[model samples]
Target chain A: MLRDITLGQYYQTDSLLHRLDSRVKLTATLLFIISLFLVNNLWGYVMAAAFLAVCIRLSHVPFRYMVKGMRTILFLLLFALVFNLFLTPGTPVVRLWKLTVTKEGIRMAAQIAVRLVLLIIGSSLMTLTTTPNHLTDGLESLMKPLKKLRVPVHEVAMMMSIALRFIPILMEETDKIMKAQIARGADFESGNLIQRAKAMVPLLVPLFIAAFRRANDLALAMEARCYRGGEGRTKMKPLVYQRRDYMAYAVLLLYFAAVIVIGRILPI
Target chain B: MALKLEHVTYIYGADTQLPVRALDDICLEIPDGQFIGLIGHTGSGKSTLVQHLNGLIRPSQGRITWNGRDIWEAGFPKKELRSSVGLVFQYPEHQLFEADVFSDVCFGPNNLGLPREEVQKRARRALELVGIPEALYGQSPFELSGGQKRRAAIAGVLAMEPKILVLDEPTAGLDPKGRDEILGQIAGLKKETGISVVLVSHSMEDVANYVERIVVMSQGHILFDGEPRQVFRHKRELEEVGLAVPQVTDILHRLSAAGFAVDTDATTVPEARDTILKALGGKWDGPAAGRGAMGEKEKC
Candidate 1:
């Protein structure tokens, strides 16, 4: 029943997007999110949607998968829609019980819902395509400028990578523990709120204990393998910007510029 | 009631890429009141197989019928099914979280929406089944020794009044005495309840001692399913699948191969000794011979 979560989950595929240098893809995703917020009109939103559609098509990632990712934040989208639908206060089209639907408000709600869905899908696309290791590598390299300020960028990235790597391991462990407890007749489903939470105690206690044990083992293993915190460490697959990378970056920049120009003209 | 799997196939993450076919076209029947051993190497689908019986996992293809009814059929409440097929997992003591032992054991029956008195009765009976003293019921479960806690956790499952009990390597990572105690408790529980028992284990000797039926799995497929002796007869097949026959049987096979008239099919040391002695014209010796036999069994 805990299988619905897809946050930071990578989908394995042999596609162009999956093969792209992680650093380039990471930068492009961030740029896309920024450009999404740059839109001020319906036409600008249309352009952004079209751009995302083309990217999804080119990446060979199934459109249905992206839609599934959007489903996770469906509640948030609906909440935004409801909040904006009645609270914006403009030319009311209908009056309901203590609520009024307005043209401007409905339009704003639609825009916000679309924007949020696109934003989530676009950023999640990057994580879905890239492995956690490569994602962290990209993050570490991108944050290299902050090294001058002694921000421990490498350490931060390393921690993030480790956390991401441990997620699936912990999930597997939790599954095993849950089954064990279930075999012991620990009923998690079909209970009152408090009973259900109490049911989880049997699953959670062992999980926490195991997590601590794993943390200890991982630390010792890292030390035994002489992991010295990324100091002077060389990557086996160093990042290289090729001609395709440059072209991709140029195309993204041009798209952002065109969207900004169109937004200014339409300015809803 | 015999639990039947009609061509059950289970695939994990089927809606996404990297789908794992954990169980592939498995079909078998586990009859009532039999101690069944499920043996497989790591990633051999043994875990997936047991999860199906208790309805912890649903098959992607095929149905698991208990008492001739589809477990996943509409209107089949999974909670009742789970109670019927109690499962005790390896290192089960770790899942104990209640402040006291009685409350921890009561978790199962209470979830079944039983009356408070029934819950308390089942809890006390379950604690008794696992041989826990009534005095210990009020103490924190966490404060108990590891073996006692493990027994208490297992008793929690028994409290559900399951008709069939499944244990996945219940003795793993425990001291020898702890292992023996858990196994002994299971034997007692089976006798007392007349419930079918399914044991998934890595040890062949444990299976030999406990289970009447054996099912061997490898690479997500059922390799063998029969009586314990029948399944273990194909020593070569078992070896190829990364499993072993009981060591006593192996020793007997060696003795028989060396021109002794010993029975290689003997699954226990005492059985092998009796077989060997009979082959030697019933020339049975006293304490020294018994000690030697014990030593040989230990070596095996």
Candidate 2:
């Protein structure tokens, strides 16, 4: 059951988006999220939706698989929808006993929900197309200027990659430990809230111990490999901006400029 | 009582883009008090099959029955099934978590809701059964040696007192001496308790040494199910599936091919020794006589 989580999971496919430089994809995703917030009316949202649709199609990621990532944030989406629906102070369209559903509130809620969904889909698309190593390389390269200000950009990137690498490993480990505890007759299900929380002690303790042991082993392995710092290390696949990246940058700039113009031209 | 799997099939990542059949149409009966060894290469569904025995995973296509009762029926008491069919996973030592070895061992019986005194009694018995000294029971499990941690983990499951013990590669990642000690204790436990055991191992020698029946799995199918001697006889078939016969059995086949009048059916060392001695016809004179007998046997 723990296997259902697809967080940071990359889907392998031979597509134009998958072949794009990780930095280009990352920058485009960031710009896409910014465009979602910058838009104010239906036209801008339509443009944003069209941009995302085109990217998703080009990536060759199945629409169903891309939507699966939304399940994890369903609760957040509902929460945002409800808050915007009920709490927004606008002209009431439907008056109930104490709550008023306004037309503006409905529009606001829909826009907010769409923005949130687009935000998640945009980020998930970046992760789904790029591998963790490529993502790290992109992040480190993006943060390279920070190194001049005494920031440990390489170390942070290394830690991020390691953390990403261990997510699936730890997930499998947790599943194994949970099964082991269950085989020992530990009841994790069918218990009261406190009882269930108490039962997690058995699961958590072992998981923590295993995590620390893995960390120690990883540290030792790195040390044995003469891994000093990220100071003077060269990447096997160095990040280079290709023509496709420039083309992607041009498209993102056009989308951002159009969204800004639409937001300024359209009345709320 | 017997555990039965009827046309059982399990598919991992079913309904996903890439579904894999981990076990396919497996039908087998595990009778009470029998020692069975499950041999397969990695990813051959050996682990998936054992997990099904305890209702840890429901089969994608078939039914599993415990003593003629379907385990997946409504209100079937899955917890009881799991407790009764204990599974000690590979690298089980990573599961140890309690403050001390004794408490970790007691985790199983305690989970069964046994009285405190009874839990303590079972925990001690399990610790003793796994050869964990009483004095070390109070020590933190993390502080124990690698082999001791593994034993404590096994004891944790043993304290559950399952009727059927399923161990998946129990001796994996251990030293040769450690492996023998763990396997020896498991064999002794099965003998003493008369509980059924399903030992999943890649080592043909370990299986040949302990189990009465060996079930060979390949590509999610049961390739062979018989006594070790019978299964090892199909050495070529087993090798095709990336498995090998016991070292002693291989040696016997080599000796037979070297023109000796020795039987190649021996699966263990003692059996091979006996076969070689018997082929010599009890001749006792000196090393020269022994060589002469061997030469005569080779000619024949």
Docking class of 1: medium
What tens-digit string does per-residue lDDT give for candidate 2 at B1-300? 789999999999775667899999999999999999999999899999989999988999999999899999999988788878999998998888889999999999988889999999999988988999999999999998989999999999988898999999999999878988998999999999899999999878777889999999999999999998889999999999999898768878888888878888887666776787777665634756656654455324
* Chain A TM-score values for every predicted structure, listed in order: 0.94, 0.95
Error at B215, model 1, angstroms: 1.5
lDDT of 2 by residue, A150-202 (tens): 99999999999999999989999999999888888888887799999999998
Per-candidate interface DockQ score: 0.52, 0.77
Please give the CA lDDT of all the candidate structures: 0.84, 0.89
Best by lDDT: 2
Off by over 4 Å in 2: B283-300
TM-score of 2: 0.94
Task: Write one digit per residue (lDDT tens) for candidate 1, span B1-300.
Answer: 778999999998787767899999999888889888889998998888888988888899999998899999899877788888888767777777778999989888887879999999999999999999988999998789988988998888889999888888888888877887888788888888889998899778777877788888998898988887788788989998778788778877778789998777778767776787788776665747675867665654
iRMS of every model, one decimal? 2.5, 1.0
Worst 10 residues of 1 chain A by lDDT: A181-190
DockQ of 2: 0.77
